[model samples]
Target: MSTLALGVIGNCTIAALIDPAAALVWGCFPRLDGDAVFPALLDGGGADAPAQADGRFALTLIDQSQSEQSYLPNTAILRTVLRDSHGGAVEITDFCPRFALFERIYRPPTIVRRVRPLAGRPRLRIQLRPRFDQGRLAPEITRGSNHIRYVGPAQTLRLTTNAPISYVLEERPFLLDRPVDLLLGDDESLEAGIELTARDLFERTHDHWRNWVRSLSIPFEWQEAVIRAAITLKLCQFEETGAIVAALTTSIPEAPDTERTWDYRFCWLRDAYFVIHALNRLGGTRMMEDYLRFIGDVVEDAADGSLRPVYGITREAALDESVVPHLAGYRGMGPVRIGNQAHLQIQNDVYGAVVLASTHAFFDRRMTRPGDGALFEQLERLGARAVALFDQPDAGPWELRGSAAVHTFPAVMCWAACDRLAKIARRLGRDDRAAHWRGAADRLHGIIRERAWNPEIGSFVSTFDGSEMDATLLLLHEVDFLAADDPRFAATVEAVAKTLRNGDFLFRYVAADDFGRPRTAFVICVFWYIDALAALGRRQEARDLFETVLAHRTPLGLLSEDIDPRSGELWGNFPQTYSMVGLINCAMRLSHPWEEAF
Candidate 1:
């Protein structure tokens, strides 16, 4: 019931993270950026153990012995089949319905749970525990004929169901004779029969997602993984404003007692850029197009030449970091934080991220808002910021806390900004601006080549004039900063492969920063290394490593933000979009051609 390997179901507006055994352990209300109404996953009795099943909403099969779970292929709908020793079984189908209604997508902040007896007689107990105000207050409940209303300080939640209301209120076991539907969301009366309405919604939602997945230009190999990752990534996007959250849960420590737990519920421009870019490869342009609005608003709203690394999903600019003392952290690690502080720090990489994301809007003919002169002018300011800070000391992409250094990764991203700007300008027929940005790119590239390369170490170091190597350099060829086989880039990759590599994973960096040497691997960095390996013509080795990494994924075929280097156990936040993007991108890079599949 407390598995970290959980399935996520959402409707672009709201999301719920359910354990393998059909328990809703973690989920926010209203939106992805909202407060956690269920934070049991953050307090699992002290040690690094799976959460105790008490604080979550669960359907316990009284006669059940074992269970099996899977998603309805190509959709976010989850199916958990609970089987008892005496041949009694029931199937629980969970999802947040999202499909086209009247004229627009009807993605409400709602969750639909449908339970049906599959074989024999199945008895089940229902437990619904919902806390409010960031797990600080437990709401009082009031039940009517069939719906239950839970009213808290600031919000109210209503659950309309076909199941006996008294059983839900008293947590009593009931016999399963027919189907029952549990719909939780806005306080509204059901229009049709509960079970029938839920089934219709499920069918429509399934068709919507399946049709969407079919539109993707997926790679030939690992089609299923790619599709799931793609779907999860899409669900993470807040459709209201086109913002993408990094992950579902927050304050899940990067390592045991490392104090590296962070709030990833907000939108990080850098992370969203990577997500949009990855989805773009699959011909998923709608996400990109929607995100373009977010980017434009961010750029336009900038009072000065600076933009935040992260922001509130609903366009709230400021997010001051703080902890929730009431709810113990994940695994009972204290200091469950609410907001992120990286917003106030300097991160030059966002300039390039914005520019990279903006490129699609300008050049892609299918886009609604193709880049025009005005948009380009607004972006020019971002390009100028990148040019100014390429060599300045600030927080790098890794967001080290203690000190700021002229990290090579963000510097190269700056180069990418100007370089991409020049390309966009050329496409727009602005020869003068193109030449200007091209000159700036060349200048930054020259600086990086001279300052970042350490001949003594025979590699491109993480920081300028420093010797420590990190996995970020694995992206050298990815950004076109260096060619795949460039001797210097090749040697840098080899050096990282020797130093940062750990079994099938790669530590983001080896050196101690603010805290100390990282105890685990940043999972995405390993996929970056895989890309580096494949680029180096180490196809067989890359494939071997890719398979090894895939084996480490949780049973649900998903990964967390961080992985214990020694145990290969998922460590950080659950259902990390970064890790999922890695899965899709690596699968695209390493999988065999569709032509050969026949």
Candidate 2:
């Protein structure tokens, strides 16, 4: 059966998910949101093998008995070792070439595979099958001297290989006496010898990743875990547009047999803010700088200063939801969605998200271009909208479809918008504007404190005057809505921990929603809870829970959106950016300071 244990390899431009057996199961071509040229991940769930589907690239070892997979240290390069029963083995190295070329970052939508025979005469069969339009269109295959082109309606892909094209085209098993290099990318011709080009790219790409990882200010403790999460989060960014996707592949159910799937290939302002904030903590300012460009475009495009919850990778505002019937969902879950309707919803939190993310650029002297008065004035427009709708709720951060409430989280986020504007104004020496925003922030703060608190429950509820707790309530301290030492804030934290704790995990909420109630734990909630615990001076408890959460990661040290509390199985989208952001945040908070450790 297919699982989220798959490994991901990509440049910022594109990524592919490879299963334990070294099969290319899921990938989008040209760009991250383009057609799924390799869609075996969503073809059928619980199948004996992905071979039952057609959209995959497999390097199958005859009489294969054991396999092992791992990332080349501190890099996105994936290494898989497969061994047959008769001591025959082959090593497969996979990566999308990303490095410096021609005085610029060179990241193409190409996947490079280098296979080397490691043991006694290994026999291998190479199958490269790519589909288009969600598996509804089969491309016209044409063979050249050394390359095969798969021509589709919108785009064409070329597979250039040093191996015999006849063997690859015929799917014939052949002896792997030497290393084989295959490059699947654009329809362009190779510039140099196949071996020389592949070798140069491999060396440069490896050096690029190592240099990039060396630049990160990762925590000393759990270095491996942090690096992996950081790399995965970086992979989720669409470099061309500077938009960070919520995940790679979508429509993976949050739990079994639930139609709770939603497309996450687009950018959610809320998720993007958290992603940038986490990366900033690691000294990854380049990502933040790139994302600011995307956010600036989003702000400029919002004529009314009202932002949507999500947008397309290329800044397309209209993300109409539609189902793809041609493809089965993750685990055979049906109704694979193409776009997100959340783009059309009124998500008030987005106002604050934009300001919070932009705030970093204004104060950091390290920024190449700091936020100036014009940007502050532009953000004030969003602040106006935040003030107008802070309490009048639409879909909250959870993006509930059937219900809209005066959710406390969005209300607090709106408060943050006003609060940040005040700080930014002070930084710009605009005393009058600062005073005005500070007053507005104070008024909203008073209102939230009075209305969001359920005195009987001793907690700030999910909604105003509602007696329910959700995991987001734990963010009161993290968001600076309340002080950690405040008795009310501590009480709210305890209330949420008591109300939402499942077996070893924390549920987002237990209340019934549009899809009955969520059965599994939202993975990021556990990290939020850990951060809250640490802020409350329960460091030991926080560290223990942080370790527990780390243990639940897939073998590749990756996480999905949700997890079964009872079984610890991952669910939802692959390589969820929210989950990775949480892991990075919690590791930074819980790790012992280097000065103390040494």
Candidate 3:
């Protein structure tokens, strides 16, 4: 059976997910949100469907017996070792080249694969299938002596390789007598020899990642985990536009065989705020800077000073949700989706999320272009929107399709927006605006305190005057909505723990919505709970739960959006940015100080 036990390789512009057997199962070309050239991750179909999907590039070791996979330390390069039953073995290295060149970063939308013989002459079979139009059509293929081009309607992919073209084209098994190099990218010819070019790119890319990792201020204890999570988050960023995708792929369901699937290839302000916050903790402000640029464009384009919950990577506003009927979903599940309907949602929290994400610009001296009075003026408009919509009914953080509520989380986020704006105004010496935003924040806080608290339940609920609790409530202290020592905050934490906690995991909510009750635990909520625990001085409890959450990560120390509470099986999109951000945040929060450890 297929699983999300995969490793990711990317250059911040394009990304691919490879399975343990060194199969390139998922990748988008030309850009991160572009057509998936290799879409086998979502092409598993019914009994009548072909046994092997026609959207992947698979390398099989003949009579394979065992395989192992790992990443090079402090880098995104993945290495897989496969050994056959008859003592033949091979090692496969996969990565996308990203390095400094010509005074700027050179990150191409390319994937490089190096397969070398390890022990005996390993027989290998290559299955290279490239699909287009959301897996509805195959690309037109043309071959040259040393390269093959897969031409699609929107983009063309060229593969330059020194491997036997005949064996590769015929999908025949062949002896791995010597090392082979394959470069798959834009339809461009290489100026240097394939072997030398691949080698140089590999060395430079390796050094680039190592240097980047060295610059992070990772926690002393969980340094490896933090570094991997940081790199995964960085990969989700579309560096060209500074838009950070919530995840790389779309339509991977949160649960099996459900309509809960949605595309995560676009940027969500709420999710991006969390990602920026986590990366900021690790001293990676470049992503935040790029994202602010994306935000500036969106703000300038919004004539009415209104912002959508999500936007396309290039700041395109219309994201009409569609179904790709031709491609079966993961594990034979159906209804693979392309665009996200959440772009049309009234996720009111986004106003505060944008403000929260931008607050760093005003205070951090490291920013090249610090937030100025002009930027503050633009953000105040978002604060006004937050004030107007804070208590209104709309889709909550979970993005319910059929129901709307005046969610407490969004209301609190609105308060945070105003509160942060007040601080920003003070930083700019705009006393009048500071006082105005301060009053606005105080009034909203009082309203939330009065209406959102359920006296009968002895805790704050998901919505105003509601009686249910959700995992997002656990963020009260983290967002400064409530103090950790406050009795109300403690009670709310207890309420969330009692209502949503399942075994060792925490569900986003227990209430059923449009499809049905959610069957898997939202991974980030558990991390939020751990943070709350640490803040409440339950260090031992927080550390124990943190370790349990770490155990659910894949072999490469990556996580997805959701996981089965009972089985610990990962579901949802692979290498979810939200889940990885949660990992880094929790690690930083829970790790002992380096001085104390020393």
Candidate 4:
């Protein structure tokens, strides 16, 4: 299209429409760890190398008269309609290759793009830009009459056209462009003038997406929204490793004009349970089983059973956060960051997430019967560590900037670990260990009630000795640590709403008490509020807030980590999985009220 519209349908795939022209991709790789062939996203339409180091390309779509776009039912495939001033129209479809297993695993993914003249005769222009190795390494381009190959150290990008389009290579920005004919007549004669056809690839990719979608078992009334979210979650998954990343892009700010920007390209164990829960609820368990296997392998690889909060999609743990000074951040939020420093921090809550996810897999009706002794030992080890560190100060769930404390949320999760372990032990006939787990759980519950609770404020504080209320504690009710009818639980929810709710949304915590500049509302916290509202029997209010949160989604139904209420713009990383998890969980809770057993 003449105008460029960039948005995401799934958390993993990014699609753009250039009106009356061609569509371009933003940030997506064959695998989670693969390089970005389209580095122009960070450079702002400038020349950059392909995700591999060998080839480089940039794109410019011009001479567009008018255009429109839409998705294909519940699938991620995108269709664009273009119109020229001279009464001509063309249709184009764009998607990444996802058909065969071998193709899915291979590097340098193929972009299966197809174009057809729908109404009248409209001339089309084609441009190909491939930058390798984040646009830093140059590739050797081998050009033939109709085929082109950009070879890098580890991968090769091949482009072939059936149309007679002249191709030339430019050095300064590293781009290629050519004009092609779009002939339209009777259906029989139209094929004679067409330059190139990718109908085979298009059919294969469409069938692939359709078949995968058919496997989903979504019974909710909001089936379209649920399917969109489910597809996004699947796209965010690294197919080879079964690890799902938090988001697609990096350096999108959480707050304007602050150093809060961080990369969300890696996997977080904290999301493991939520991811599995979402998939299990939606009637898809294959991906969950693969993810659990990945988790088991990670546990076995670790010298100790203890795990890091985050890691690469491939299970690599060494992620060093650094700034790329050369490129300006999104909307000039300076110092684009790659990798995450939070990887090194010790977040004890992850242990609970892992235990809960594995246990869910074991108990879920769809999953294969799990090994009792192995899972029990894993839980016992994590429980033992929690008991030993119950009183220690460590980074809280938010990964705060200062020293750690006995964070209320982690303490409650520690209680969950002990509690779930006891249940599992009893089920497996480990009476001795079950007794020990129950005793430890009782002690942890007492600690949470005595140290974390603040009767003076009538709610639990953020930390053991602090007076500030945390929105994270609202999760205590969802986790079953406190019943919704408990007066103390209701008081804590009220305190959090009074303190953290900004308009209809909620902040992770009170910003005025923190060091960073005040930011927009966290999307996940708002969903938490929805869950709290439903649990409290405020179903209508919960649905209203859920719809309001949905209104913040981008034009293509993608969500970021945060939303700027004042500007109505998406902030933080795009297509955040945690945000989607929050959405799907709230939707499920609203649909099936009795599923809140946690």
Instruction: Please report, as a residue range, the 10-residue window in candidate 2 with the lowest summed lDDT.
Output: 44-53
Span of ten consecutive residues with least summed lDDT in model 1: 45-54
lDDT top scorer: 2
Error of 2 at 318 (Å): 0.8
Each model's lDDT: 0.86, 0.91, 0.90, 0.67
Question: Which lDDT tens digits does candidate 4 get at residues 291-317?
Answer: 887777676676466778898888888
lDDT score of residue 429 within candidate 4: 89
Model 3 weakest 10-residue run by lDDT: 44-53
Instruction: Candidate 4: list runs displaced more than 4 Å.
Output: 1-5, 9-25, 28-30, 45-61, 100-108, 168-197, 512-515, 592-598
User: On residues 1-598, what C-alpha lDDT tens digit does candidate 2 reach at each position?
Assistant: 6788999999989999998988998999889988988887887752245443588999889899999999999999999999999999999999999999999899999999999999998999999989988778888999999999999999999999999999998889999999999999999999999999999999999999999999999998999999999999999999888899999987888998899988999999987568778988999988888988899889989878988899999999899989988887777887788899998898888998999999998988889989999999899999999999999969888999998999999999999999999999999999999999999999999999999999888889999989988999999888789999999888988898898999779999999999998899999999999999999999999999899889999989999999999999999998999999999999998899999997
For candidate 3, report its TM-score.
Answer: 0.98
Question: Cα deviation in Å at residue 532, candidate 3?
Answer: 0.5
TM-score: the better of candidates 3 and 4: 3
Give the TM-scores of the predictions, in the order they appear.
0.97, 0.99, 0.98, 0.87
Native-to-model Cα distance after best TM-score fit, residue 222 in candidate 1, in Å: 0.6
Worst 10 residues of 4 by lDDT: 182-191
How much is 310 displaced in model 4, in angstroms?
Answer: 0.1
